[model samples]
Target: MNWLKSGFELSFRIRPVGIALAALYAITCWATWRLSVDQFFLPAGIRVAALLLCPPRLWPYLILGEYAYFAQMRYPMIEAYGLGWVILASACLMPAVALIIHLHRKAMEATTEGWLLSVAASAALVASALKLGLSHLLWPAPPSMPFYSNAALFVLGDYIAILTVAPLALLWMRRRSGYDWSVWRLPPTLAALCSLCVLGALIALVGAHDPMARALLQLLLVLPVIALTCMHGWRGAAVGVPLMNLMLSVTMPTTGLPSSFDQTTFFTQQIIAITSTALLALGSRITHHYHQQARPAMEVSQAIAFSRSAHLANERDLRERALGLRRIADDIEAALGETAHLLRANGHEGPATDLLRTFSSRSQQFRELTSRVYPTELEHAGLYVALQAGGLREAWDSSHRLVRPLLAGDPCQLSMGLQLAAYRLLAEAVLLLLEEEKGQILIRARCGRSGGQLGIVFTVALLDRHSTLTPATQGLAIERLSARANAYSGAVQCRTNRIRIMMRDTPLDSAWLAPPRDVSYSSETSARH
Candidate 1:
């Protein structure tokens, strides 16, 4: 059975003849129903679905089948209604179907939801109006029924058929065309089963004995339709609502229905249409709200992750630079020592001694510059040593600057990137204060877990009101500090004479900082005094 079904589906996809044949079969089967004053019509569903699903080329086949079916059904009415009226009624519905197909093509994409109700409603209104107007103009009414009543019944029946059946047919065709069915979960299925069970039990218990109970049961049937709409969106309501309508049509007594069959069918169809529309609209609103909320959070998370990646890359580059500098310095010292010894052996003690002193001085200066550019102390000891290097502590001891460390965590636990960023930010801040000729600069730093992120906050503020710092100078300082902070997924803020910087403290693995072995800096060639 499964193999046969698979083969049939495969043939339907690969063979155009198979599709045309299927359309003819469906149209012929559905269009056989007798047209009456009050009963719900079925061919409208088949017609609308076929128009929507079939290609434009295949429409000829659908129309041909429809015309043949209508000819057979209208043979008895031909004497009273005329052949032209039957042809007009059969052809009038095509315009409404075309309008709906236009709308569906314009907006029916996978992500779009809740449009089913509007399309169905529009199709129903257009089809009902056209069918009703043409019926009145072309067909003679029975003596027992008024023109208005018959027109109303015609419109209501068409509207009911289109609303209840067309949507389900469209959904089935969509599924057959390869729409994923996994989105239809357990909730709608449970709601549908519960609705069917409740409806069956109610019909059996009432059995036309209690008019009030039957009416209440009809109303209660909408519960599952509402649930289905809310849970599985419009597709659920499309299928569930139509199934409930069919159940009610089969179980409920025709005489016990509202004042007349037309009134009851109209009222029932209207209730389902309105209920489904409201539930679907509400579901769409809620889905949109959640998407709106999640989009920003996702963007922020991505931005942070990107910043962290760039920060790690920068850290690796800095580490390689530091390693290259150290290697160059060692090579230069070795070459200078060898040159001095060879010069002395050639009986040039005076110049050789002078060259040795000069070499020592230049080597020390090179080390100082390398330390300032990439703090070796910070890498080995921590931020405290790096901040205190190069007379920073002496300036504080002289009361020329005020440096205070409020660190809370073990600096060794932090990533090398974080430590480097913190050291650079502090150094820049202190330099800015000195450049502004401030009497004193207060430095405060603390590191610990805050809000699930292990991080540190370092702040620098001027103690004197007479500092020479301008707004532009402060802005530049803040900008420089922020650049460094952001390298470690951190932020910087400045106000007046004060600047604060925060950074994430998660320790990065050393393997990520491995230097490229193919690149080498020769100390003797690259080093300069």
Candidate 2:
């Protein structure tokens, strides 16, 4: 097993070897999929999965293998359906589906759950529309069904196929290093097995001959999906959808099931697709919400630990983490945005219309939280703008305290590290002082040559002498300020009615003389270019 793994790993690295391996693998999968079950075109899923999982360079090999596999069937198809029909079949099922999904990979990578499933479903629709459109228009597509019936099944089949395969392929890539096998937990496992057992029993009792029983069984398939999704989020649907599909394919008698000439199957397949997509999206959101509620400190520690020896962090890393936090806000905000849908679902039309107006801004409060996690605004707007603008100012305004000459110095001159540390210090200090319900705090800063070193000194003071804040709370604030200041080897001081935090870092170089408006320009500019 190890030797085979090593050989496969090595082959994937070399250009020609990788191409050959991908092609051969594609052909083998295509053959096996064709022989597996005739209920659905599993190759459609494989074709879409290739685009979802592999890079552009590896795409041609997979497409070529699929084309070669279809080429064998093409000649026999021509003998039965004539050369023109055969040509149309080959053309419709070309590498174009790969291209369609290739473009959608970006939308799939988007942070929103709706974006992930909606875009992918749309891609499947587009592909199926392409294939079904031409084939239905030109020839009588099989099963002795109407054109509309064939088209519905065609669309639903692709949706079912793509959902079954693409998400699992993505999940495989997303698992952490050496963490692939750990994803299957006991709860989801038991839920999946129980679902399979129930489905098997349903199939045995109904006996496939009864159309109503068939429809009933198909409808009940969503129960397992709901259970699994409640248990494990998107990962649950990834397992359960495919598992249920396989169970239904193997257990149900495929040939004699006749309801509206098999339109019942199409209707049920659409339900399954919709159910899986909804489950994946909602499950992912719920999972993220719990994760955010649970691991805020872990996230902060991870941010600090990810820091490097350089003056500033790798901007990509910072941006990624920042966007990650922003996405938390997005998910939280999405709940509001979808309130209209919920209201509509519950049949509350009048208020649903009104609720859409403020739905966009409902999560404005979380902006402060996201900003605190990683100050992405610092990349574009400087330190002072970020502080003075958002929820950060509430610390002063709400408590009925006035900070005189609230901020000073050229915040842009401070190194990125100093600026962020200073911001956190100021934020923490303001938060601590706000406990008293009223206290004045002043932040004063200077950036330039301090002896032989180039750095900045920032001071935060509690101007109100007659405040009720405890010394322990004050001490904790100082400790946090000190932690932020540690990167600059700066100072933290606590007086009777005040606290002072000073920080300075990186050499005072020519660049510090007239610092640009944007502190982290090197990374931001390069990234834009």
Candidate 3:
């Protein structure tokens, strides 16, 4: 009869892989029932994996296949009509499992660890309960085991099957779909060593008759599984767990069934389930930690790249503006020369003389404005020479004490943008002090290394005790200087009667800069005094 049953199953394969999987599941169900040390079932994991991996449309075929297999397996144990009842009950159970999986599809599909196990366990328990209930109501006589004991066995077997086998099935399906598996590969030598250690431990435990020795051996099994999980993440857990189960099955003796429930086997199965869950959770956590660590570094690198790009764009724009201004200045100078020559030739000597003088004055102003826009002198001679020659001290009269030199730096080492920013900051600060009529202003400029980057600082101090320049009165100067300084990733600070501008020697690239706000006085102002 068993031979016929086996032959029938072997002949039941369909061409489609889904059908093939179902046939394989049915064969496993029969094999485990007959060959397992206890009455453990192993079909729940295959059923859940099939439902998850295959589309919903193909589920009915899988259910039908499972039902056919279940009915065939029960044929020898029950009457022909009773077989109908058994098949009907199985038919109902298969769909119930499918329906539960459908309801919790999101949880089943999550990449995290606990979701699959939790859903599978819940479905197993509920399906087992429903089957036991139907049996009690429909069967003519009570089964050999009491109702609760039978139900417990059913739930344990189903849940264990799902926990042990479902992850492997999921991984196999993922591989078929061309998912990347490189992250899960461990060094071949290390994996073989760990496997051997676990196998040896299990073999030793098999010979031990004491329950405590077996328990200790079971605990020892967790170490290699943990090592594998650490090495390869959840994929490691998936592989290591099933290997341990296979080893346990082979090493442990399969003698006569326990007169009562096999408490030792049940305890070992429970321990295995707990170990699998822990390993999976650990792997998931390690993956999450690596992701978290990588994110901030990536963000900073992108920011630096973006800043450099923006600086290049701004430099290009400024170069175009300088060319346009130079052309306009040349045209105005030529026109003025022609107009003066025409007047002189027409014998209007007095008017031509005045006109020439006026043209010269306006030409000088134009040259200054052009320099402010893009300083050719600063570009060529460096920041110090440009400031000394740029008329900053001349802007202030004898009414205010003139600070001799207001700029410092190795102009060749500095970028064009940095040079321009420093020149503008000093120019703006001197203009502010002149406009405010601040007497005896002391201007100091210094350049040095700061925080691994070259930096420049300009300090403008009002020496007159009567000078009363508050933040409110100096708002316009502060705003203009701050905006210009920020364009080069620099800062301007205005304290009582004094202002300081500081900047990194590196040229700014990012467009983002804080707008000018009310300046708070610092102790540095008093220290400078």
- Model 3: ten consecutive residues of lowest lDDT: 520-529
lDDT of 1 by residue, 235-324 (tens): 666667677766655653443222224344355555654664575566556555656787898686566556656766776677689779
Model 2 bad stretches (over 4 Å): 1-39, 112-116, 136-145, 177-184, 187-192, 201-217, 256-263, 288-295, 301-529
- Evaluate candidate 1 by giving its C-alpha RMSD to the native, one decimal: 18.8
Q: What local lDDT score does residue 75 receive in model 3, on the 0 to 100 scale?
A: 60
Better-scoring candidate (TM-score), 1 or 2:
1
Local distance difference test, each candidate: 0.63, 0.60, 0.64
Candidate 1 lDDT at 213 equals 68
* Segments of candidate 1 deviating more than 4 angstroms: 1-95, 103-118, 130-269, 279-404, 410-424, 437-442, 447-455, 462-498, 503-529
Runs in model 3 lying further than 4 Å from the true structure = 1-40, 108-111, 172-197, 200-215, 230-233, 255-263, 285-529
Query: lDDT of model 3 at residue 325?
Result: 87
